[model samples]
Target: MNTGGKFSDAELMEAIQKNEGKNDAIRFLYQEYFDSLSSLITYNSGSTEDAQDIFQEVIVSFVQIVQDGKFRGESSIKTFLYALARNTWLNELKRRGRMTQRNKLYEEGRDRFAVPPSEAFENREIRKQLLAAVGRLGESCRKILALFYYEGQSMKEILEQTSYENDQVVRNKKYKCLKQLADLINNDKIIAENLKQIDHEQGF
Candidate 1:
């Protein structure tokens, strides 16, 4: 694995180009970029599992770029890799119905060289508080809410997965758990401030 960040761009490209040492090249890429890329997803309302999934897709894309012979060495591998990861994550957010208008505008303006700040909606403090609030809920509430909201599962699906009597039971639990979370946020002055900033920045 490329554990020491000692691999050069040309060497990386070459490694990917050649069949030999290909797995090593992939391992090297994972060793180098996984943590940062995973954090990018996790901080943007994604769970660790979601981050892992996104990074796997990013690796596939990185490999394809190299194999296609279009890498061009135009930028450092890290820059290109990051651009790919961020774009992929943003698209994932959109597919999950998590992207807001602010995210849309931000995506439109993103540079190939840098990820913009996550303040508009995916605020770090907001993420932190949300996780905390959810953690404070009972296990049933947490599981139900995560399934319905984060996992985007339907009430029927949730009913099948849980011990609920029916879809209505699942729906009621979700509503109450979400309400509890909203109350938590309402009580947290810092979270409220961060949310206000998000709306203001997004021109909402």
Candidate 2:
């Protein structure tokens, strides 16, 4: 079950689960699938950068599915991934206030493999809004927040990875970044509306 760097379905699942052939597996997945997935996003009124983010979300979802023993191999991994990417993008469009029938149009004639969509790794609406707020930050704060929050690195790990002087400094920077993000969120009417909508949905 070896040809160049492509993994068979079984090998892909094993590589993701065991972390041994993981790097090669991921690299091959990206090399083989990024373009097609990204094109799907771009064709659906999203930008190139949006495509990148959607693909990253797709990969995160796929990896989680593999790790959690949810990938039952009823379909090939490629088909599963494509369906997952499509569903993930559809979810994003709905979140952005788009209620288009184009999603139905796209799904109408596809051989949507039996593998279901998994959003286990996609950000919830609130967190996604906060990420947008964070994206509005300047370079340093963005990096700090990304390293600390998104990457889930420890303070010590971040200190080693970044150029901060010490833990206190890093904490201070993170605090400032959080405050700035809060201010940004507060200032955005759309984000505030989204928060309220989330709360309403949750019966808050």
Candidate 3:
């Protein structure tokens, strides 16, 4: 079976299980599987951002399972990853109370690859609006928000990544940037409806 990278399936599994070159293995997984797994969400009732978040969650869970010796290798890694992504996305949809007809069909073992035209359009609009909102932010604010939220960097890490003098400065800047982003998002009804969860998640 093609493993989609320099490492074969067994090689990747061994690296993960033994904690040897595991970072490389994980990076390989990201490059090889992210597009396929993320499409599982984006083609469903999820945005690109949602797909990215779910993929990250799935990678963490997969690493843990491997370390715990729970991955029996009964299935190919690709199959296992797709299963994880599907289940994770389904649970997210349930949590958001967005189990639409397509989702119901997915649960019933129907084809879920078909993207509804309206959902595609709405996803495009949401991306456009979000980019516009981010563009309105000052360069420093934009960098701070991107590092904290999108890259999941801590204040200390942000300080190291940027020219900030200390953690306190990074934290203060991040808070202000998040507030500005929230304000921009709130001003647009469509963007607000799509991204309202960020405010709660970021402790705004």
Candidate 4:
């Protein structure tokens, strides 16, 4: 079978398992799968950078299964990948406190895709406000926010990424950056009104 056009997970696996050089097969999978996966992450409280990091982790996990010869073909490749990506995103959301364990468990039980409501207009507005506030933040502040919240990097990892001498320094910096962002949002009357409108719509 041609290694293109969303190969059945079986077909992709067969090719991957048997092809002496299945780099093209792997590349085809990435091209077809990356956008959908990235969009799913972005829709569920992730930024573009968040999307990239999660997708990369998913790919790594997929490859590990293949290399270990542990894929049993019990599920289609796409289905398996979808499940893996969803679980990863849910775990990330939970870690961030954006979602609770109950919501994650509920989502795991459902065959259907759970999406944020179209009526969550206020959340969208808040995201816009938050992003604007983030933009106004200094470079160090922005980097800290992006690394911890957006990239899902741990504080230890962030410490390494930020060139901070220690975790305590990083923690203080993150608090300051978040405070700065909060202050900007609080001071902006228009954003506050928009947020209020959204809160009202959500009956919060």
Query: Candidate 4, residues 93-167: lDDT per residue as tens digits?
Result: 755667865566556663343222431334444555676777899999999888898668899998877788999
lDDT for each residue of candidate 2 in 1-204, tens digit (9 for 90 to 100): 333476777888888897666778888889989999899889987899989998997787788789888888887887888888877777787768775787668756544555452242133455577668877899988888888886788889889978989988999999999899889988977666766765666598
The 0-to-1 C-alpha lDDT of every candidate, in the order given, reads 0.76, 0.77, 0.77, 0.71
**List of clashing residue pairs for candidate 3:** none
**Clash totals, every prediction:** 0, 0, 0, 0
Q: List the residue pairs that clash in candidate 2.
A: none
**Per-residue alpha-carbon lDDT of candidate 1 for residues 165-192, written as tens digits (9 for 90 to 100):** 9999789888998899889878988788
Winning model by TM-score: 2
Residue 42, candidate 2: C-alpha displacement in angstroms: 2.2
Model 3 C-alpha lDDT per residue in residues 1-204, reported as the tens digit of each score: 223457888988888887778888989999999998888899997899999998987787688777777778877888777877777677678767779998998878622443222223234447668789899999999988888885688888888888988999889888888888888877888876655554555477
Deviation in angstroms for 23 in model 1? 0.6
Q: On a 0 to 100 scale, what is the lDDT of residue 137 in model 1?
A: 89
Q: Indicate the worst ten consecutive residues by lDDT in candidate 1.
A: 113-122
Which ranges in model 4 have alpha carbons more than 4 Å from their true place? 1-8, 100-204
Cα misplacement distance, residue 203 of candidate 4 (Å): 46
